[model samples]
Target: MRYSVSEWTKSGSPWVWLNAGAVAICVIMVVGLLGLIAMRGLAHFWPADVMQATYTQGDQSRRIMGELVQQEMVPAEQLRGAGIQVPDGVEEMRRDLLKVGNRDFSSADFVWAMDQGISDKTLPEMIMVAERLEWGNFYGYLREVRESGETVARHDGHAKSPEYLAVWDEFQRRIDRVLEIRDQILTIEKHEIGSINYELERLRLEERSLELEQSTDAEAYAEIEARRAELNADYEVLQQDLIDLYTKINRDSFTAEIADGREVEIDIAKVVRAFLPNKMGTGEKMAHYGVKLWEFLSDEPREANTEGGIFPAIFGTVMMVILMSVLVTPFGVIAAVYLREYATQGFITRLIRIAVNNLAGVPSIVYGVFGLGFFVYFLGGSIDDLFFPEAKPAPTFGTGGLMWASITLALLTVPVVIVATEEGLARIPRSVREGSLALGATKFETLMKVVLPMASPAMMTGVILAIARAAGEVAPLMLVGVVKLAPSLPLDGNYPFLHLDQKFMHLGFHIYDVGFQSPNVEAARPLVYATAFLLVVVIALLNFSAIAIRNHLREKYKALEM
Candidate 1:
């Protein structure tokens, strides 16, 4: 009988072939998508060069080259004097900047340094001559990467050339030495100023005391006047030293000159590490782990002289996530228990079911708006009027911040927990309950000891799902706790142990920042991808853990499946 249907279907249409084709196409699309992303995002870690027409206006194309660019004008000037023909026009017209694209040397037209020199244009000439001409990216750089130190793309064989690395080391060393020397000089100048001020103060006090004394002795007055004169002279010298120090510190600004269309302009900084090879992008190493997290946080304080630290954001996010979890778990578990165990499938139960299901579909932004109006304005405003009359906006618990974010997320996820727990309870056979009842156990006892335990695994799944949704979600939190930058983390040793009303930072928001709002989009690109991947991983880890727990519970109860 089954053979009849199977045979008919087999002859009617090639189902297997259709299915195979569908699967093949699906696989192809998936692979294509993954490959595309990989090519763009993971291909920036290696070295490549740029080749272009000698004219910038000719073609906006890139060519990969295998040379590094360092600005050492000394040798270039020397070579020019030797009648090296100075290769002026070629170096000047940087049509084809060098770069490594897709992480590796994607194409190979690069042999030696371009013969920009009229003659004797060897690699050494490029390195040593330090061309008076501009240093520009052919593709952009001769390093193994497109980024300074961070690895941009993977599988592209971009890395720092040994020569470039040496140059970087020397350059950095020189800068550090110069900075140290300058700092030492500044410190000495400051000490001199302090000493002078102190002496001046002493001399002024002596003069004041001398004037107050009705001393007929001319010697005492003469001594006081002489000391005052000496102090004045010292103050003049110190003031001059101070001005010089200020000028020196402020004047000698460092700049990295790169090639412009016609001439060279100072680029502010030369990233030799940009010439180094990296398979991943994480900013400069010293910047990352060099105890410079504060520097990174405060680097872009919104304005040029602005100051900010992501510590507050980091703290706020952690607090919001943890608080949201804590607030939602108990309420969700209780609701699920009542629905799964005590409630019957009557009109009331159905209504509750409908309501919970509807709640899950509600727009999170609506919740944020509601929270701001009702919780912040109505409730919190009332509280402020009552107790914190002096501090009108203080005690902002119900306001649009971490507290509201946690609450909104918790509300949004309650339905998920309810559904999961209900399913889990239903999976337990009625026989188990009947047996418990027959043994004289009450409904409450049966639910507590039997149904609830069995349903916990399902509840965990719901919790995990809720956590994933909450953690990665930027929309609701954006209206609630998300902020551009916070000076400190929410979990600081501030007065309040848990500042629910404080603005916080989340990883999702960070993705938005790097990808869209960051000043240097190309520079921050790898960070954005890495942050996104990390968030995905976090969600996956939570869900996988829940699944594992569910599996364990299933195994534990397998023998008792009535």
Candidate 2:
């Protein structure tokens, strides 16, 4: 009744080919997706040329200047559907998306211009693009530079003028000096003044504590007052220095002729970088691209999370994952060791394993809710009451923070660690355990010195798995420590260095915030892609590091386990 061998071969070969084709197709799709993401994300930093064009729609005509971001073709009906008129016999139309910055003046940072409406498109050699600190990007023609209400240099609508070059050089020099002064101001404000404030708060708390203890010694109060006065004098001096620096930074200003023919004045200190991308040669553009990339990586976010870097988010994500691994490994391993090596092999143990497996599949939000109520409110409140009673009502640990976030994720991923470690322990030969016992070694010694070392690779596998799950987790972190914008990092130069109670930023939440919650969607889109790509890269790097260590351990213990 069975099929002949020839028939079976024909059928089996077809199925094998079909399976291979499916695998190949999947690989292609995955590669294409990653390539698209990388292309879109990395292009955000490239210096794009500025285009000056005349745009006309119906009876309206105006000149527009900006970066030509993209071009596309669409059916004429689509244009008409949007209330735009299509010429007779036109079946399709071309449109361009322009990044018309100068958000302060323009209603939108980006606009779509139909090919039928645009005329006299030209890449202007003199058009300048200014990356600003507050108003997104500014695209216009450089007019002149001013200092203290007097004209220092005027462009005269000339690109090769000595006056223009002089002004540009002076502007560059002033920008360097302004940046230096700005750094000084930040250091004074954030670190110097910050330390003084912390000391003052500690003193106030000390005074409160003394009052609570009924120790109202006049000499103690006088000493505290004297110290406070010294700190106040130091703060006052730093504040005056900051004021002087700000005045110096604001001394120089530049005028730009916008697309509407109106000249606008912008303070030099407000500009992050100003460059004529249209005029830049290959080398210049490459250099500019490098600078922009570095800035994107190193700087802090500005303009509603639409501009600048994501350094804080990157730091937070990595730190949280590391902390989670540190907290999860020992507990997960110990639990697995006890269950597999010590506990009676029975129905209850099997039921416990099933429960652990179910915990892994439970929704992450459930974990967040549990962490919020149990860790943040119950346990954290208790700890705060006991250790940090002085900072009461302020809720030091009694709110979402780094420690709770890390622990929550550890709890979420612990099941995977336990399962992996248990599987590993089961793989070891039974005779190995019995041999150690027969050789007069204690069970603990055998497990620690021999069994655990052999199981190290599997333990690492568990950690790697835990990290992968924990690093990309956003829903739970939203209720835990992650914020749209953290004012300061959890780890800083302040006392204790590692501030577990402080809130932190995460790249996942950053992508979500910029992509979905940003006020300037167009400006935030590129950043979303860039941040997503960076997050993927970070997770990959962390996993690869763990994998490398796991491989080394596996190699080290291969012979012993065999």
Candidate 3:
């Protein structure tokens, strides 16, 4: 009554194993793809350091300015002491008294000191800039320079003030600082180096002329030598002062310069003034200059591709889909033609049917490899020789671009069209074909005038399916046309504008580059998700267009009955 081990195994059968294998594969593929896409496309928005930086530039006062915290808040008593009349507003006038306790009065530069991107969450701080380093906002700069006990003018932010000429007078002070003119003529001894070379040269020439005139007296010669020695000693000491001046050149001496047709300078003090969020103009630069904390969630592409009109990737994908559709349609319809019209149901026809169906069941990626090897290298190379001899060695039709990408995708999706067209051809009633032949129509005419017209809708359905598959395919195009960046589009303003030979950008490739291939992974995530969504929408649009065209073709043949 017991069964043998061999008999038990045979009773279980192979179909069970096949079905289980198919389900397992489907689950693994779907789960793996979704996981990979989400992990790369939704994690982080911005880099870390930008979120934490306070002062992006330096703080210097001599040539630069800090925030004007307390410029001109002279009291009425002080004005009266200086014999100046106070304005009518008196104490009611706005004061530059930026105090520490009150949170309402704010300067423009405090929010900039935070250096973070837009946040609706917390209230920002107000910081006052001090005229000297010690008085400036504590965290506004990386470091500060303490001022010397020298006279300095401050702006009152008002139109009528004696210190209004301070900015212009700064250059004058710099000129005087350079010479220290008073230091040279100590008791007409002139032993300091204060632009005294001119006086020394004049005296030297005078002594030489005196020597040439008459028998130069010993007393006169001694007097001339003594005066020349004093000037020489003065020039020598001035040379030492010039050496000291070089050591003091920090941000204090930075001067505005003009160069060949460009303004190539940056004022650090101006940047600090512009840093406060309240002062910025409403533009993109204001959104993220240094860094934004939300970059971790931002979906921006790497480099942002500011050049206004280069959408090469989108163009390439569309071009490839069109080319693939054109190539696959004819081959699929013709093969269906041979099978239905001419190929008799012999052993060879059955074997061909079996082979065609088997090809449809084969994995699409395998077709991609076959296309790369056969169409790109063998058939493509052959055509390049016979028709495109000028582009030798390079193999014009065989390299990566719109042409090869299209051809490769066509080969990959051809089986789908073939199967679909065969179904359409099979759906035709035998009576219709017989009647066409009875009416003295040729078999080819019956196909051209009747059979194909009747089957156009079904034929279109296959095209729609092929396009949908090709539009979202990133792997096959990776081998054929997808590149990280293309300087120019495949189509542009030139002779025969559609340049199929150029490498193309693709949304799929963009997703890969932004999510996986980028230098800053966290900063590109949101952009990657948005891009992925765009790719999905694009594929749907293509399918919808194909469906519309198919419906039109179907309507054109509605009266032709099978």
Candidate 4:
């Protein structure tokens, strides 16, 4: 209790406290960041109350309706600079960013309104927000429901009369039917017809290959023609089915009065969801939130990735990471084994180790460039020239793709694995190896049966590190394979099941694109946060899986280490 400063220092209590404090600060920062992300991103799914008001600017007045997005107080000088008139006495003004959709009619999907100029603000239960397949959301008052250009039901003004209720019911039923039709169309187009097209392409490639080889087999040519004919027949049938589905989906339409007081006819097929947020109770809002969140996760992105789901990006990110893991582990482990167990520990070996360490420090973008040049262009182009000459001019493997992206990331993160494995190998007691050697075991046998099993936990540690780095990497992937939108997933029900040559979407790249490159910045802001949080969750899941395996291996080998 009476220890001097020197004694306290010597006891290491100060250092321990400092270290613990640092760790605590780090944990707090991480949790805080994640909390912020979750709040901003996940809240986008919640149905906020929509507001209707009359907004006046100078001598002009107009009706405005939208969900209140954000509000901030700005200096009067800033408003004046932006050509907004403020009363002389006012030093500051509150500006509100409202997501007034109906993008087709309005020049902007979001608008900044001066709070002082807004009056008669009300949440009208009759107001409907239509989530659409195109042109963003449509916020308005439902006026009429029509079938095949004939009015089925109509409402007067913003009244929720019996006629309006009937119209609403009919609209909901039609939406459900259209959604079912849309699913069938998607299945036909993406799966059934898609498979047929793939087969047809393969047949064409086979014929080209035969021609390239100068094969004069008449039967082979006939067989290819026969397959093509069959595929064409199936395609025609699917095309007819799609046409019918489209006609059915497009048959119903509704008219809505937007904020500008113009009634526009919208096809039911374009409407993804229509909801009256003002009328919704807590339970209904929660259900709606769940549905919206699920759609964000499971639906394909629309409106330039500002709307819809990120499922494709999620799939691509996971697939590429998995591929990278598979490719990096063996190479890294082998290199570590050779360096630690077999190679002479000479000057050259020391240089190699230094080089490996340096490689880990190299800029990730540099790896991306190298990947683009060597992996995508040189190696892939060579393979294409040799094996796919028939598909020339299209580039095929010579272009950025899932395989090349994975390979590039593997190269980028392999140094981590090598270093980790070497450290693990160094920690293995020499006596353990000697004991195995003394017990009639060859060097290889001892390494395989004893040393490797003990070092596996470390190998997994390396893999977890690799996964964390590779999963979040966006730069290299952009150059190698990641795209703003991928037409089809790399993995599908095709013949090969996994198409490594296909380009793919990635969450990291998606966040960058949506956050920085989107035309609708306000609309895309929440999505960027949501996507970043999802990416964090995905990386956490992958790391947790690797950690579990590492823990199991560590537990299994605890006795050996002892």
Candidate 5:
């Protein structure tokens, strides 16, 4: 039987339907947003066929070679306004953004061309796309391979010629050799020499500390000098090794014929990978895509974070959130326990609850400013002055760093934890406490054994919320610690293992820097989306871990609640 609208409202069915509808809409929007991000971001890794075409504008016909990045229909008026001569009868025109990525040879990495002017478009098997260490991708044909300034192999005009295949084979072998050498150089510099440098710095600091303390220890000075000598010897050896590796890596060079029919010599050291998209089989393409995706996740960023992977940013974001959770949970729980269990329900307590609620509403940037001022400058400076006087003139803790950023986020998210924990505490049946007390248990023991165990799921819920918020936060991190690029990870093989005093990268900040601060907006656009999707995934992973714990806790304490 159909109910009247008033009757349905009276029965609360309308409100239920409304609430369900709202929830459904929210879920749909969120899924759609994630889908859009995934589509735009993930497609960047796939190898698209590079097109060779003649682009004619007015009287000048030029050869254009690049991947077709985006296509859009634009009003003829807009095209004409941009000084392009649109045909008179055309009301709208299709424009294609081609990623013509010989950045060193071209004025732009990406150029928009009217579809009408694009002629003789073909996916030529000979077209090679060279992913580079700098200046972006190079779309060209491999013309010659040179070793130590001597011509090793030269490509003929024919694509399938034996000479061309031999040249390609030689190029691949040289690339493999260069890559192996590059890895050795990186290892020597980043780890082996890095350790030596770290020890040398520590020695210097020790020497300074002794000087500050007015120590006359002759043996100490001698020891420091001997250590310094050893380090210098190690550095020299590594330096020589580095020189050799560089010489080897820079030995091979290749000449490529770009779209404009100009031959440019590119050192093998600068080329990251070279692939012919048109010639690649499906399996090869898949393998290439896998490697690219892995690099995006595992490698260090290059070219102002517009290219390369965001591993550092990912590491920093996760580390900060973990630290924030650890710092916030106990303090928040203690505060909540004192408020809900120990304190008298009076005006003062009410005032505190009000204050805690209000703290949640404060602007995140305000938290950032406060963190920069108090946590970074004031507290950190005081610590540095007292404990690290030897490292004077150079502020150690008195700067934006991992520890300060973590603490700042802890403070920012504490209110959420406190409120959630207090609610959890309030939900416990008083009889449970009374029963434990009646059985000769102390208030603390009863609270710990019975009440807390039952309330842990709520505490975890709070922690989950805190993690969700802290992980995605970028503004406060910018002030407190996050940098555009961190040369080294805060956590590494160095002594103490974790260097909380070091500034670190965050995915949110990476996205911001790539999306807005990048010099190449077109190049960075897909990266921004990809990074955003990864950020979401990271946050979800953190939240899911907390949720899993919460679920376990809930299960463990289900009987008591019943």
Candidate 6:
């Protein structure tokens, strides 16, 4: 009853099964990868109990305290090769990765401790984890809370001590106040006084422009000076306000005992957050997790992007893709329309179609090189020289920036749009065009009114494909406009809010930086997973929006279809 290969092919059942299996495999792989990323990334925000343990090595014992990161069993041969003594009968040695914070005091923030050598492990309910602004986290016992060198709340690291609760309440209040004042200072520095500084610079540039033109009239000079005076006055007031706020913030301090029995005084202003994870209930832990997750999403990164939120990267990535979409759509649609509708059927047109297809196959790095050479250097340099000569020797548009990145991505993805759009235009019925012409509509009107409306869904399809490609591109962005860290966002409250020439961060570049470029690879690993998950979500959202528009257009033009 066995069938021949030709008979099986003729039946088509084998091919159909093959296709279904392939699709299932592909889907499973995608889901598995995403699940792994989520497990690693999202677990970083959860509050884990601090283990205060005694770690012994070579006849020396030291107190070690931090989060238990991971555990593994390693072959005895491996440990012996690394100069560690192992028992003769033991086949393997157990090791635990401990996140021993206080990087400032220790050589490393994370270390591997042999389970055989470690003893006296305890989870102390009074142990506190202080997330600081620098040097990563600090794990210790809260000692004394002070204000202006006067003891306010003192604790002896006892679970039944009321002083610990008082200290916690007072510290929480001060932290809230510090955060409020910090925001005020940031607003003034980055926006209020920032606006003044920007205006002053603009005035200086204007004066220089006038001087270059040999038109530095007395009246014009006086007007510029007047504006400068106003800006300076505003800056003085803001400077005083900052000084007062700084004084207020530094007035509170606390002392905490580290794992090694030394108490260190920490300024309240330096503490980003303080939490007692061992004392928290399930509901409290969940609430804390939610807050931490929110902070990761909304706060600007600190400590080399291993800490804080990735809002800037998220914003920059979305902004760049939107700009790329805006630039690619019209150019691709117009080129496609000409090729499909207006151009005579000829060899040259066919060659253009071939070239467009070939462009899609080119490596993204090649596009990056072209963008760097032609867009950033050649075209942008010429623009800066012609229009921004007053700021010579300092590049304005003649450097990697947001606009150049968008344009580079648009150039890279235009081929997809053109191909999709041409296919869409080809699907239109010949009678639809003839009918519009018969009704006295010009060729342009027919394209604008009848043909394009029916082709709207296709344009959106092209845009979706373009966005999908552009959002994930990291190599070209690195060469053109993406940076390790941008001090300011491209869009801010400054005058002429959208500054196209400013450099920006991107999620793709951020992932590369954190995963590969970070000094603390262990600390940064979870962030890599989290950032990757977020990037996938962003791409999905962008595609969904385009798909929604395409669906609407398809329904509207259903009557026009043949």
lDDT of each: 0.54, 0.90, 0.56, 0.94, 0.93, 0.92
TM-score attained by model 4: 0.98
**TM agreement with the true structure for every prediction:** 0.58, 0.96, 0.50, 0.98, 0.98, 0.96
User: What are the per-residue Cα lDDT tens digits for candidate 2 across 1-562?
Assistant: 7988799787798789889999999999978987888888889899998888899998999999888788999998998899999988999999999999998998988999997788998887778888888988999877888888788877757365677677677777767777887788888888888888988988888777677668969999888889989999998998899899889889988898999999999998898878888889999999988988887788889999899888999999999999999999999999999999999999999999999999989999999999999999999999988887777788989999999999999999999999999999989999999999999999999999889999999999999999999999999999977899998888888788899999999999999999999998877888888898899999999999999999999999999977
lDDT of 5 at 134: 93
Runs of candidate 6 exceeding 4 Å displacement: 1-9
Residue range 290-314, candidate 4, lDDT tens digits: 9999999988999999999999999
Q: In model 1, which range of ten residues has the least summed lDDT?
A: 124-133
Task: For candidate 4, give the lDDT of residue 312.
Answer: 99
Which residue segments of model 5 deviate by more than 4 Å?
A: 1-5
Candidate 3 vs candidate 5, lDDT winner: 5
Backbone clashes in candidate 1 total: 59
Candidate 2 error regions (>4 Å): 1-23, 217-220
Ranking by lDDT: 4, 5, 6, 2, 3, 1
Model 3, span 1-562: residue lDDT tens: 9988788678886668888999999999977876666544433211111111122223311111122123244566765575544566674222331122111122322222111111232212211121111122212211111124232433323232345344324533543443343223321232233225545655665565565566457887787779888877766775666545443322232122111111122222211111222223446334543333233222222244211112455666777888889999999889888887788989998898888888766776776677678767887778876766544566567676777788778877777888898899898889999999999999889889889988888888989888888888888777776788875567754435676766788877777877787653433455576567556667888889988988898778776651
Model 2 lDDT, residue 429, Cα: 94
How many angstroms is residue 245 displaced in model 4 relative to the true structure, after the best TM-score fit?
1.8
Better of 3 and 4 by lDDT: 4
Residue 49 in model 1: shift from native, Å?
A: 5.0
Clash total of candidate 2: 0
Task: For candidate 5, write residues 331-402 as lDDT tens digits.
Answer: 999999999999999999999999999999898999999999999899999999999999988999999999
Root-mean-square deviation per candidate: 15.8, 2.3, 26.4, 1.2, 1.1, 1.8
Displacement of the residue 244 alpha carbon in candidate 4, Å: 1.7
- Evaluated at residue 350, the lDDT of candidate 6 is 88
